[model samples]
Target: MEEFTIINENNEFKKGKVISVFNISNSNREIVLFSSEDFDSENANLQIAYLNIDADGYNYISQIDDEKVLKEAMYIVKDMIEVINNG
Candidate 1:
């Protein structure tokens, strides 16, 4: 499993598993899906981040603040993984 460190709105870093990676062909963008399981709270939080690749090929997730977009990305990631697994 791939691991990722995500920064929340408060600028706190949270470590999670990289559940999925999505490529946006039209825009040349990559979206990463993260699943942060909080065992203490018995909750699983989903986070969506944009993978920004520099000219030299170094990449990182950009900061995001839209909840709606994050939720949509989570759905997209789940669907994508489901399709891949089913096929």
Candidate 2:
């Protein structure tokens, strides 16, 4: 459970733990999902973020190529967080 320091658009800094890092099949790109304690406007407990990675470096924000991919990541993170909380 590695943690990272994130700086937001307001220049606010937050500390979060890494939940998972994964790559889609047949793709060289890497995506990292992390959890922060800060809640969004909706007040979601687990604030999940994905970093877009390329050959050059990481992009500030990431876009989902497919809706299924976003859904899959949500499921994966949910399961992982469950294990961490209940196990």
Highest-TM-score candidate: 1
Q: After TM-score superposition, what is the CA distance of residue 66 in candidate 2 from its true location, in Å?
A: 0.7
List where candidate 1 sits over 4 angstroms from the true fold. Answer: 39-42, 54-57, 64-75, 81-87
| CA shift of 57, model 2, Å | 4.4
Question: Please, what are the lDDT tens digits per residue for candidate 2 over residues 6-83?
Answer: 676788666666656766664455556766555354331345444664678645445567667677767777777799
lDDT of 1 by residue, 1-87 (tens): 377665667775666787667864433557877776653466678767787778897766775456666666666777887889998
Candidate 1 CA-lDDT value: 0.69
Mind sharing the TM-score for model 1? 0.56
TM-score of each: 0.56, 0.47
